[model samples]
Target chain A: MAVPATRHDHPPSRRAAESARRAAGRSLRLGFLLACAIFFGLPVTWLLLAATKTQTSIFSDHPLSVGSFGNIAQGWSNLLTFNDGELVGWIWNSLYYAGSSVVIAVFLSVPAGYALAKYDFAGRKALLVLTLIGMIIPTAALVLPLYLQMNALGLLGTPASVILPLAFYPFAVYLCYVYCTTSLPDSLLEAARVDGASEATLFFRIVLPLSKPVIGMIFFFSFVHAWTNFFLPFVMLSDDRTFNLQVGLMMLLQSTDAINAEGGFSALPIHQPEAALAALVAVAPVLVAFVFAQRYLTASDVSGAEKG
Target chain B: MTDTETAGRRPARADRQGRRPASGAESTVEPPSKRRRRLAPYFFVAPYALFLVGFGIAPALYGLYTSLFTDSLGAGTEFAPLGNWGEVLTDYRLVDSARNVATYVALWLPSMLMLIFAIALVLHARPGRFAAAMRFVYYIPGAITGSAAALLWLFMVSPQVSPFSPLLDLLGVENATEAVSANTPLILALMGIAIHAGGWILIVYAALAALPRDVLEAAVIDGASSWQVAMRVKLPMVSRYAALILIATFAAGTQVFVEPTVLATGVPGQISSTWSINQLAYYYATQQGDFGKAAALSLALLLVGLVVALLVIYRTKFYRIDRGLS
Candidate 1:
C-alpha cells in the first residue's frame, strides 16, 4: 500500500500533484461525511416534519415539507386522546423504570466493577468470565427465560420485572471495570488506606469523586438500555398501563392504522402524525441525555478493556 | 445490613489465617482493619453477584431445563430432552428465518463495520468542530430505538410519503405494501445501518481519539500517507473495537425482533409474523403457548452468538486481565 518515493523526486509538478491529491481527498472525505449525515439524519428530519402535518397531508404532501404549527398541535391533541392519554402514562413509566434501574445499575455496577478490577479475590476470574458472557448474551435468549422466571415468582407485570433485569447490566459493569483498571490509580487508594481511611470511606470519597466520568457513562448507558429495551418489558408486562414507551408505541400503532392504513382499524385518529409525535416524545429524552452525556461518553473508554 | 456486613467479613480473616502457617508473621492475631480490607472486595461485589445469579445465570440454566421437557394437553409435561429442540429444529419456518437472519447479518455487518471505520477514521483524520458536529448528527438517529425505529423506518421505506420516494419510484415500488413485501431484508438492513451505524461511529471515533497521539505523529513524520497510517497503524490498534462491534452487532442481528415485529404489525399479511428467528421463538411462546420451543430456539440463537463471541475473545485476547490492581 505504500507509494514509492520516486514521485517525490520531481520538484514543482510533484508538489502541485500532491497538493491536488490532498485537496481531492479533503473534498472526498467531506462528500462522504455529508452523504452519511444525510442518510442518518433524513428519517429523523422527515419524522419531525411528519408530526407537523395533518394525517391527509402526511401522505399527500412532500415528505420533508413543514406543515402548520396548528397541525402539530392537532397531532399532539390526537396523541393525547389515544386510550385517554395512555401515551403520557407510558412516558412516565419509561422515566420511572429507566430512572430507577439506572440508579440501581450504577450503584451495583460501579462497586462490583471496582472490586473486580482492584481485588485478588478467589472467584475474580470466574466473575469476570461470567460478566463477559452475560454482557454478550442476546436479549432474545434471556427474555423468555426471564419471563418464565418472573411468572414463577409472580413478578410478571410488575415494574420490578423490567427494572430488576435492566439493572443487572453487565456492559456497564465491564465499563466500570475497565475504567477502574485503566483510569483509577492504585496508589491513590493505597494512600487513602494508609491514612486509616476505611475501605468504604476511601471508595465514597476518593473513588467516587475520581470516577464521575465513568459513573456518568454508566448512568447514561444503563438509562438508555432500560429506556430502549422492548422485548423484556413486552414479555414481562402484558398490561398496557404498565408498558414503557417502546411497548406502548407498538401497541398504540398496532391497534390504530398509523403506518399502514389497510391493516389497522380506523377507530382512533392516531395516524402518521400522531405516531410521529409519539416517536418524537419517545426519542426526545434519550436525545437530551445523549447531548448531556456527550462529554463523558468519550472520556470513559471501554476500549481500555482490551488492553493488557 | 451492618450485622451482615460484619458477618461476611469474618470468613476472610479465618480463611487467611488457615492458609498461612502457624509460624507465619500474619497467621496469628490479624488486625480488624486488615481483615476488613481483605473482605472489602466481597462486600463490594456481593450485591451485583446476587443480581447476576438471579437474573443472568438462573434464567439461562432454567431455560436449558425448560428446553428439555414437552408440554401436552392430557399427558402433562414429559421429560423428552431433545423433544422441543428437535421439533424446533425441524420446523420449516426455522430454515427460512435462519436464512433471513444470515442474509441480514451478511448485508449489515461488513458494510456497517466499514462505514463505521471509514467515518471514524476520517473524523479522526480531521478532528474539529465540523467533525464533532458530524458525529453528533450521525448519532441523533441512534436515540430513536426499537418501536420508534420501527415507526421511523416503516414510514421511510414506504414510497408514497417517504422522503426517499424518488429512489423508491426509481426502484419501481408503487406502494408501501409492495415496497415492504418485495424488500423486507434490504429495507431492514438499511434501517439497521441507519439506526445502528451512528452509535458505532461515535464509539469507534472515541477509540480513535483515545489512541496515543505520539505514535500517529511518528507515522506521519515517517511520511506514511493518511490512508497508509489509518489502514496499518490506526486500524490495527482499533481492531479490538472492531471485534467488539462485530460481536455486539452479530448478536443483535441474529436476534432481530422489533423492526420485523413492528413492521409486520403495521403492514399485516405482507411480512410474516414470524419473520426473524427470534420472532419465531416469540410466536412459539406467545401464539403457540409453548415455552419449551421458545426456550429451545432462543438458546439455539444464543449458542450461535456465544460461539462467535468466544471466537472473537480468543482471537483478540479480549479479556486478558493483566494490568489490574491485583
Candidate 2:
C-alpha cells in the first residue's frame, strides 16, 4: 500500500523521465564496457581459440570453432622437439637473467633509493638527476656502449655481459625513492636515533621491514625489464646458450622474416600454433608475478613509475 | 675535532649513555661508531652506486669516445670526429626509420590514449568485479613480451590461418602484409604496440577512482545529468592523470623497437630492413660492426629523448607531487 502511494506521489511523467534517464545511463555504461571487453579482451580470446585449433582448421569455413585441447599438448611437444630442446635453454636463461637482476636490484636499488629519500647526502641531487635521465633515455642508447665494454673486457660470450648492465637499474632506484619519500615517516627514524639506535640497526630493524611493498614493486618492474630486454643481450650475447628468451624469440621470428616471391609466406619458422604456445610460455612468469604483486602494485606504484 | 674514524664507523651512543637496549642483550653485539654522518649515505648507496658509475656513467662517456672514432674494414680505429654522425644522419635507412617512428607516434599516441581513457572511464562508472576482471584481462597482453605479442598478432593478421581472416578479407586484406599495410584501418604494427601498452589503462582507472563520490552526487543532486557530470566533472578531474600517461607514452613511443621488427616479417619491402631506430643502431653496431656509427646514432636518439623528457618536466609540471595538478 505504501509503495502504491509513493508511486503515485510523483507525477507519472516525471517518474517516467527519471526511469528513462537511469536506463540511458545504464546502457551507456554497459555498452562502453562491452566495447572495452571486445576491444581489449578479444585478441587474447582469439589467441587462445586459435591455439587450440590445428593450423589447417584455422582457415576453414568455421575458423572460430572450439578445437580440442590436444592441440596445445601437440604444440608443446613440437616446441620441445624443435632444434634439440632449444627453447628450454632459452627459457632457463631468461629466468636466470631476470631473476638474478631482480634480486640484485631489490637489494641494491632499495637501499640506494632509501639513502636518497632518508639521508641528506652530498651528490644526492646529482645522483637523482642522473637517475631521472637514465630512466627517460631509451635502452637502445646503452647497448652499443655496453657491447664495446663487454668486447674490450673479452666477456662478450658470457652471461656476465648482460647481467652487469641489467644491474644498473636507475628506474627502480627512483621508484623506491618516490615510494619512501611519500610513505615512510622521518619521525620514526629520528625517534630510533634518540633511542640510541645506530643507522644500520635502524635501517635493518625498522626501515627495511616497512619497505616490503615498494621492494616487491621494484622487483617485478626490474624483472619485467630484464626479461624482455632484447637489444642489450642481442648485441652482447651471441652464443645460443647464453641467449635469453627474448633474444631467442627474436631468432625464432627471424626464420620467418623472408617473404615468398609468389605473394605468400613460407612455412612458419615454427608451426603457427607452437609460436602461440611459445608466446604463452614467454609471458607466463610476468602474469604470475602480476597476480601475486597486484595486491601491492596500486595506483601510487604506477604514478611513481610514470611521475616519479 | 678531526676526521679520524672512517665514515662507515658509527658512534657507540647506547654504551656511552649506559642504557639497556630495552630488551635482551648479547655479548657479541658491538655498538657502532660514527664520525662522518653525511658519508654514511654513501655506505647505504655504495652497492648500487658502483653499478651507476661502472655501467651507467662510465659507459655513457665511453660511448661518446667510441662515437668519435671509426673502426673500418682493413683499417684500425681512426680518429674521425662527427664522421659517423654525418654518414648516419644522411643515410636513407635512418631517415626512414625516424619517419616511420614519427608516423607511428602520431597514429599510436591519440588512439592509445582515447582507447585507454574510454575504457578507464567506463570501468570507473561501473565499480564492480566485472570491471576489475576486465582490467586484469586488459593488462594480460601487456605482460606478454614484445616479441610474443608480435607473434600473437601475426597469427591474427595471417590470412592463411587466422580466425579473423574473413574479417580481414572483408577489409580487402589478402595476407598479413596487407592486413598490416600502412593504409589499413587496423595497422598490425600499432596493434602489437597497443596490446603491450595496456599497462597505462590501470593507471587511468586508478585516477578515476580518486574522484570524490560526494562531488559527483552533488552534481547529480544539482540537476546535472549523468552525461554532464561525466563530461564536466570526472573528465576534468582525471585529465591530469591522462596528461601524465600521455607524456610518458610520448617519450617511450619515440623508442619503438620490437613491435615493428617482429611484425615487419610478413611485409617485404613494404617495411625496411631496419624498421626502427633502435634496430638501425643495433644493425650498425652488431651486423655492420660500425660501433662508431651506432654510437653516433644512439647519441642523437639520446638527445631527442632528453628533449622529450624536458618537455614533460618543464611543460607539464605534474611532478610537483604536493599539488598534483588538481
Report clash pairs, candidate 1.
Answer: none
Writing each residue's lDDT as its tens digit, candidate 1 over B96-139 gives 99998898888888898889999999999998889878887897
Maximum-lDDT candidate: 1
Clashing pairs in 2: B9-B33, B10-B32, B10-B33, B10-B34, B11-B33, B11-B34
Docking class of 2: acceptable
Model 1 chain A: ten consecutive residues of lowest lDDT: A299-308
Can you write out model 1's per-residue Cα lDDT over A68-114, one digit (the tens) per residue?
A: 88988888888878889888899999999999999999989999988
List residue ranges in candidate 1 displaced over 4 A.
Answer: A1-16, A114-121, A151-156, A177-214, A298-308, B1-41, B212-225, B324-326
Clashes of each: 0, 6
User: Which window of 10 residues has the lowest lDDT sum in candidate 2 chain A?
Assistant: A299-308
First chain TM-score in every candidate?
0.83, 0.80
